[model samples]
Target: MEFTDHPTGKRLAALSLAALGVVFGDIGTSPLYALRECFHGEYGIAVTPENVLGVLSLIFWSLMLIVSFKYLTMVLRADHDGEGGVLALTTLVKPRKENMTRGAWFLVILGLFAACLLYGDGMITPAISVLSAVEGLGHITPLFKPYILHITLAILISLFLLQRHGTAKVGTLFGPVILIWMASLALIGLHQVVRTPSVLAAVLPWHGLHFLIANKLHGFVVLGAVFLVATGAEAIYADLGHFGRRPIRLTWFLVALPALLLNYFGQGAHLLSTPQDAFHPFYAIVPRWAIIPMVILATMATIVASQAVITGAFSLTSQAVQLGYLPRLRVTHTSASHKGQIYVAPVNWLLMVCTVGLVLGFRTSSRLAAAYGVAVTASMLVTATLFYIVMRKRWEWKLPVAAGLTALFFTVDFSFFAANMTKITHGAWFPLVIALLVLVVMLTWERGGEILAERARGLTKPLDEFLKGIADDPPKRVPGQAVFLTRSHNTVPVAMIQNLRHNKVLHSEVYFLNIRTEQIPRVPNFEKIELERFGSGIHRIIAHFGYMEEPTVALIFTLCRDKGVNVDMNTASFFLGREKLTIGTPPAMARWRSSLYLFLSRNGMDPAAFFDIPSEQVIEVGARLQI
Candidate 1:
């Protein structure tokens, strides 16, 4: 909606090209091997022209229905401010209650789990795409077979080496390369289609249905294949903030849609004409003279897809920090022009290492496909569930329609997940392992906070009463106006209450601020903030902000004036506690995980910037505690 920070212009054509480069990288490249897998599932090969065509048709319609109708057209409009990730969406849908209910919180947790699954997908995408491209070496010459690993390693290493520099610098090449890749797909597929016009049958959705209804075993594998085509569809919605809804919709309808269909149909035709050439259908479609160039182009496209996912992971992590699922880390804004463009060093290197490990371990796209769908599928299901809640609760859509749509999506997604479960022994474990580890860390941080909060309540004093007591004394030594930002709604922080009781120091006109996030797109005026007066100049200000809204200290402090709470911006000293969580008894996690949380928390983004509080005016008091 904002077209992000950097305005790229009103020329729809240029934006479409950029969208193709950024948004469609994952789904566009699925043509390379998506079809080959449809025929070669876990059981055997019984793919016919009708079935393949049916599968391709299913892929097209699935993208149209799930991605276009469900997400891009509908869900993208439901942005929490201009942000469009799963977390933002979840925040938009979280239900309000009198008490902090676990049921409402579970939705947030599921959305977080979906984000974790995406990290797994992020690791595997580059590996599988690059490996699949490089594996074309085997098709070229048997001698190339021996050198596949070296070539793949070189390609992957080069890709990782290029990460420090932003994609904007090299992005001109992505569009043209992907365009060429699409052309190659069409050219190869067209050759086979001319030989057997019957291959055109795959364009019909009913054919895919017949294949599914008629053949049970092959249909399950086809779900895995269909899953690939829609893998990056979620990016269209996630990146809606980047390119805007119109640009992405236009690109998907005009350029991306045609290119993908032509290439898929071409591949289907090629396979039908030369059924025995099924060993490597995509590469076989190209002439000998064009094969090397195809491989190079494929390599380039896969790298682009990988880079897009890599950057996406960085953005998601940054958002997670803002929303409090992650600990603060060092986030360096990479782009001078784009506030959304960020570079997280740890995320970058970790991704590069994990991707390289995945590429080497899987060794081929066919093998990597096993791991691909599970994470994406799980993510899709989670998003669908969240969206249903948004429709019913937020948008006030009819219960039946919302529930039916959600159930259909969940059924499809879970079935694919069940099918991929069989792939666990294969390289699929890589993503599952990554997802579980991330899930544990996320839940651990949250649960640990609850444990600490409970402990703090017992030990801490009533902050309002404490401040009132200090005000009654009228200490001449007390400083100017003060604003203390806190995470808890009740009484003094354990850190501060302990500090004052043992090491007594008090300030006049003390403002206790509690910044709490609500579970809706926007907070109503009634829910904007709550101020309850305490005796003396001391006051408790509980500000309820939607997760979508940027929490600016300047704005909130100004609003405090309207509510009859006074604070001098220049003289008001803001105090915030920086909790350094430690391992102790009544453990929320295992020792190793606690160690990981400590490590992650230490590296998290500084709290000063997170709250938009100026560093010079803010005093951070460190508190060591066990969660």
Candidate 2:
């Protein structure tokens, strides 16, 4: 069930609090390095009073326009059955691919690429966040400088290793800890802001515009670092299903946005007074005594941010697999109460490896910051593009209205993206390369699945024709029920044909089961199964599930029982087709793609295990196919 389904007072408050921990984690932790990067990072500018106000203005308006207006107010409404994300948005716009326009298809591909980009963001967020937080120790004492990298790596590794245990136990602490973190940000930032009230004038858009006009090309480059403040904005929409729109919006407006603004302005205030502290303004505002405690709290907050990103990656993988863009992987549901909490072993480990590599390679958060915003900015651009389609197609907005709003969003997103592009030589290429690789995999997996399905259709006979043949030349009748898994209910399963050919017998009750994934987030139990009886105890049952859900044999049987189709699991023998794919004479795919596809197919989770089917009752019928 969606978190927003029952929006009572207590539930809404709880969800909003939870939203603070998860949805705002990435963006919430930006104070550690965002403003510092603007003045002291790879493309950092001079710390003049005007420049400081300009940068602060840019950061301020970005949060207001991009995060607050575009994402929270606009994109959040584009959810697909209460689910949000690039994949969810893609499905919402194009529920069915039949007769889709070229523009529509491009949006879908763009959305996939966008989702792939998040994987890159997922890797960088943890590394940079933890590194930036740990770097605070160096400010405390020169003694810790040598151990900063080691400490960051240790913390990151420990955090990832704990993924299998699930977040339920520790998740409770996230809300309270983040609440404290946000409170600390506001209090410290306010302390600085009160000392230098002039920093508040950065709220004016003219300071930002004047800085851009005065600095020219250099000012444009500064935008790349300035964009860091808006990095985790996408997570707000992504976690929509988990917390609901109201709670997420409420949290951002009432809690996250205010704290973030106060802290950023405070950093600017500190910078205006003591420009030398530009190296670490976030820590500069803290009292000497509180520096160590703040460091500890910052480390914990960054860890929470990293956890959110890791969880997002797992969720994205599940959605991509169900939506047919990715190969099926083993998904372990972490929280019994929260369906959104899941663990994918492969994703978790791959992320840990990449994240650790980033920390080791970059050596510091300032260097890692150069690579951070590229994927996120690109992803936001994709979201704006997709949101335009959503506004037009789903929301039915007028052409002018849709185009105007999209253009505004596009301008902001593209500016950030273009600025980030300049960092390609520094370190941004890493995430871009990662994104490209993932996009290729997604495209290959999707194309390969289509080819395999086409080949399977050619090999299997039509269901009506096969049933008529069975009626005319009746096979030897056997006791119990036989459940044959098929991709389409309109065709006979190759496994069923192979079984009858070898054993020359049919079970008394035959169930031709087809499990289909829908574009929506979920299908209600009542509408999940469609049962049609052909004749002679032969039935065709189509189990419909949403991309967010897992399809299992046990659940199917239970649903069948509810539909008056008594399915005795103990007596039922499940038949499955195990295809051994080989390269065709005229290669349907490029050689490398074919090889990758083959490897993925070979390594993919077994169907029986994936569907939670009983292994002893599953009878695999082997078939050779070329594609």
Q: Which candidate number maximizes TM-score?
A: 2
lDDT of candidate 2 over 1-627, digit per residue (tens): 466475869888998889899999999999999999999999889999999999999999999999999999988988887888888888877756676888878888888888888889989999999999999999899999999999998999999999998999999888888999999999999999999999999999999999999999999999999999999988888888888888888888898889999999999999888999999999999999999999999999999999999999999999888988788899998899888789999999999999999998999899999988988998899899888878887889999999999999999899999999999898898887988899899899999999988999887899989989988999999888999999878999999888888899999999999999988899999999999998899999999999989999899999898778998888689999999999888878998899899999999988899998889999999999886
lDDT of each: 0.73, 0.91
In order, what is each prediction's RMSD in angstroms? 4.3, 1.1
lDDT per residue (tens digit) for residues 1-627 in model 1:
356444445666677777788888898888777777877644334656666677777776777777767777777777766667787777776665455478778887788888887788888888878888888878888999978878887877777666666665677677677777766776676666677677666656787688778778767766776677778977777887777777788778777777777777777777666667666678877888988888888888988888788888888876665556667656666566655556777777888888888777767778778677877877888888888888887889898988888887777678777766667776667776897887887777666556667765666677666666666765444767767776677687654564465557667567778887665434654567788777666678888875434566777777777777767777787787777677878566777767776777676666677667778898777677775
Per-model clash counts, in order, read 9, 0
TM-score of 2: 0.99
After aligning candidate 1 to the native by TM-score, how far in Å is the CA of 432 from where it should be? 2.3
TM-score of each: 0.84, 0.99
The segments of candidate 1 whose C-alpha lies over 4 angstroms from its true place after superposition are 1-9, 40-44, 47-51, 97-102, 140-143, 187-195, 478-484, 489-626
Off by over 4 Å in 2: none
